[model samples]
Structures are given as structure tokens and as C-alpha cells.
Target chain A: ELKVEQNPLFLSMQEGKNYTIYCNYSTTSDRLYWYRQDPGKSLESLFVLLSNGAVKQEGRLMASLDTKARLSTLHITAAVHDLSATYFCAVAYTGTASKLTFGTGTRLQVTL
Target chain B: DTAVSQTPKYLVTQMGNDKSIKCEQNLGHDTMYWYKQDSKKFLKIMFSYNNKELIINETVPNRFSPKSPDKAHLNLHINSLELGDSAVYFCASSPNQGTEAFFGQGTRLTVV
Candidate 1:
């Protein structure tokens, strides 16, 4: 069974502050994804890290994957109030079925 | 255009009622999935469909059933809804099994 764990389930930050959310999986997987969800809204794709040492960035958000360590990280640089949302990291095992196991989301609250 | 879409953003129904949520993806992807998010913010995979074939079926209750009429749509039907079934349901699609998925806005199901 594959299990995903995320750190700092709840985060409160001041505007313009930086933070990083960590995601660790119990098994070996090569694909990782980061998604953001606002209250009462569906998830928005943030990043997709497909290989070892793969990193992707968009605006103030960056995501990296380390396949050897079975870990992924989503770094938010200079977060704004608009960035306040619940973030989740998911792991997909490399196979034909390709089902994703999701982590317990980290709820971020950014105050102005 | 919306890449992925789900019907009935909010659903309120009584226990033992039967309900269905419709999902469609215009991204021309070959894989679609159903996920449930509980109150604790834990997102779990309920079903995965690839090319209209069932792929991954997680440890979900028998009341929950998924139907993929075509490659672009996957619908979820729940029977004898219980209070525990009140949660957000998401529909997603990916190009293949190991790729990043595009998600719908989600349906918030409230079992009264």
C-alpha cells in the first residue's frame, strides 16, 4: 500500500513571507504533483514533477522532486494573501494504471 | 474552454437517496479518475478509468459506483447515501496513466 504524508497540516503566514511544504511517500514513485484548492472551489494544478531532480516553477511557486528519497517539496516564495489556500501533494506510481495517492492537504492562511 | 468539468457543484440530499454526479473532460485525455475528499482534508482515490476501462478501484464503499461512457466522461453514482458520504467529489483526467491530471471544480455532496 502506498501512503503519502505531508508536513505542517496548517500554516499561518504573513503576507510576503516564504514557506515550503514537504511531501513524503512510503513507496518508490517517479511522478509527483502539487495542487491548490481554495475554499468551496476545486483543485488547481500547481506543478508536476516527473523525474528525479525534476523541478518546475510558476510565478512565486516552485516544486521539486527527489525520486531517490521518495520526497517532493512545494516552495512558496513571498506568498501573498491570494495564495491562501489548501495545498496537496500527490504521488503516482509509474505503471499502466497510474493511480494517484494524495496527501493530507496543508491548509495555508496568508494574512495581509 | 474548461479542460475538465463536473455537474452540480453543490448537492443536498437526504440519507438513502440515490444521486449521481456527471464529469466530462474536453482535454482529449485517455484517463479519468474519481476522488473523494473527506472533512479531515484527506483526499482518496475512488476509481480510475483508462480508455473506458476500469483500472484502479480503491477501498471505497459498494454504494459508490463509477461509469465511463466514453474516454471523455466519467460519472459517479452513489446509492443509499449515508451521512459519511458527505464530502467533496472531484473528477480528473490525464493524458495517460503517469501524467499530471487536470481536475474539475468538484461537487460538494451534503447528505442530510
Candidate 2:
């Protein structure tokens, strides 16, 4: 079974601070995804890392994937109140369908 | 227009009742998935279908049944609902096994 784990399950950071959320998987998967979910809302796709060393950045959020190590990371360059949400990293193993195994989400709370 | 959409954004019902959640995607995707998010915020994949064929079924209870009538529609029917079944259910789809998925607004099921 493929397992995905994330660190700092809950993060509380002040605005303007920087933090990184780590995602580690138990199996080899070239496809990794990052998603953000606000309170009482559906998940929103953040980044899709398709290859080892692939990195994507949008605004203050950047995501990178390392397939060899079975790890991925979501880096927050500068935190803002708007960035407060639960972030999840999912690993996909290609079979008949790309089954996604999501990591334990990191709930981030950015305060003033 | 919403790429993916789910009916009954919120549902509240008594235990032992049966309920169904409907999902539809207009993105012309070939794969659809159902995920459950618990109160603790843990997300798990319950079922997946590709091209109207069942492809992935996780270790979910038999009471939870998923039906894909077509390539664009997937419905979940829960029989004998229990308190533990109370959670937010999200429906998502991707173009194929190698692309990023688009998620629908979740259906929050609350069992009393």
C-alpha cells in the first residue's frame, strides 16, 4: 500500500513569515500534487509536480518533487493571512487509473 | 461554469438512513474519484472510475456503493449510515491517469 505522510500537521505562523510543509511517500511515484482547502470548502489544486526535481511556484507558494526519495515539499516564501488553509500533498501511482494517496494535511493559520 | 459539481452541498440525516450524493464533471475527463474527509481532516480515497469502468476501490465498507452511470457522472449511495460516516465527500476528475485533477465542491454529510 502507498502511504503519504506530512509534517507539522498544524502550523501557526505570523504574517510575513516563511515556512515549509513536507510530504513523504512510501512508494515510488513520479506524479505528485499539492492542494489547498479552505474551511468548509472543496480542495483547490495548487501544483502538479510530474518529474523528479520538478518545481512549480504560484505567488508565495512553491512546490517541488523528488521522486527518488519519494518526497515532495510545499514551500511558503512569505506567509499571508490569505494563505491560511489546509494543504495536502498527494502521490499518484499509475495503474488502470492514477490512484492518489493523500498525505495528512498541514493546517496553516496565518495571523497578524 | 463549474468544471466539477456535486449536488446537496450539505446533508443532515438520522442514523440508519440511506443517502446518495451525486457528482458530475464537464471537463471531458476520463477518470473520476470519490474521497472522504473526516472530522480530523484526514482524507481517504474511497472509489475511482475511468471511462465509466470501475478501476479503483479502496478498503471501504460494503455499505458504501459507488455507481458510474456514464463517463461524466458518478454517484455514491450509502446504506445504513452511521455516525462515523459523517464527513465531507469530495468528487474529482482528471483528463487521464497522468494529469492533474479538478475537484468539485464537497458534499458535507452529517449523520445525527
Candidate 3:
């Protein structure tokens, strides 16, 4: 069984600050995904890192995967107040069905 | 048009009631999944179906049943719902077994 853990479960930063949330998995999987969820809303897919060095960015959010290290990072660049939400990283294990194991979410609160 | 839609965005019922949530995806994906998000916001996979066949059931209680009439539709039915069953249920579909998934808006179930 693969377990996923994330650090800084709760984050509070200024509107202009930058931060990165780290996700560490127990297995050696190359497929990782980032998702965002707001209050009372379903998850929104942020990035999918398929390969070892895959890095994707959208707006102020960037995600990267390092299969060798069993780590994935979600970096928030110049965060804004609207970006306050919970972020989750899920690792996909390929089998008959790709089982996604989600990590402990990081709740971000961007303030002035 | 909504890529994925779930009916009854908000569901509030007393404990020991029975309810069902319907989900439909227009993306023509082959694999669909049911995920439960608790109040603490821990999202866990409950069941998965591929082409109207069951794929995964993560040790969930037997009271929760998933029916997939077709490839594009997956519905969740819960019998004898309990207080602990109060959570948000989301339906998601992917193009393939282990690929990018698009999620529905989610159905919030509240058991009082």
C-alpha cells in the first residue's frame, strides 16, 4: 500500500508572498496530480505530472514531480487572496485501475 | 456545458434514511470513480467503475452501493445512512485507467 503525506497542513501567508507545499509518497510512482478545492466545492484539477521531470504551471501555481525522490511540490508564486483554498496531491498507482492516494490537504489562507 | 454534473448539489436528510446521488459525464471517459470528502476535507476513493463494471472498492461498508448503467454514468446509493455519512461525494471520470480525471461539482450529503 502506498501512503502519501503532506507538510504544512495549514498555511497562512500575505497576499504577495510565495510558498511551496510538499507531498511525499511511499512508493516509486511517476504519475502525480495536484488538485484544489474551495469551501463547499468539489476538487479542481491543477496539474498532472506524468514523468519524473514533468513540471506544469497555470497562472500562479506550478507543480513538479520527482519520481526518484518520491516527492512532488506545489509552488504558489505571488499568491493572491482569491487563491485561498485547500490543495491536495494525489499519487496514481497503475494497475487494473489507477488508484489515486490523496495526501493530507494544505489549507492556504492568503491575507493582506 | 458542464463536463461532469451531479444531481442535488445539497442533500440534507435525517439519519437512517436512504438516498442516491446521480452523476453523468459528457467527456466520454471509460473510467469513473466515487470519492468521499469528510468535514476535515480528507478525500478518499470509495468505488470505481470501468465501462459499467466494478473496479475498486476501498474497504467501504456494504451499505454503500455504486451502479454504473453505462460508461458515462455512475450513481451512488446509500442504504441506512448514518451520522458519520455526512460528507461531500464527488464523481470523477478519466480518459483511461490511470490518467487525468475531470471531477463533478460534488453533492453534499448531510445526515442530521
Tens digits of per-residue lDDT for model 3, B1-112:
9999999899999989999999999998999999999888998999988889898999999999999999999999999999999999999999887677789999989999
Q: At residue B24, what lDDT does model 3 achieve?
A: 97
Model 2 chain A: ten consecutive residues of lowest lDDT: A92-101
- Evaluate model 3: give its lDDT: 0.91
Better of 1 and 2 by TM-score: 2
Superposed on the true chain A, the predicted chain A of model 2 yields a TM-score of: 0.97
Model 3 chain A worst lDDT window (10 residues): A92-101
Give lDDT tens digits, candidate 2, residues A1-112: 7889999999999999999999999977899999999999988999999999999999999999989988898999879999999999988886555788889999999999
List residue ranges in candidate 3 displaced over 4 A.
Answer: none
DockQ of 3: 0.75
Ranking by lDDT: 2, 3, 1
- Give lDDT tens digits, candidate 1, residues B1-112: 9999999899999999999999999999999999888888788889999999999998788999999999999999999999999999999999998578888998999999
When only chain A is evaluated, what TM-score does every model earn? Answer: 0.95, 0.97, 0.96
Q: List model 2 lDDT by residue over B56-94, tens digit each.
A: 888899999999999999999999999999999999999
Question: Candidate 3 residues A70-107, lDDT tens each?
Answer: 99999999999999999999999866667788999999
TM-score of chain B of each: 0.98, 0.97, 0.98
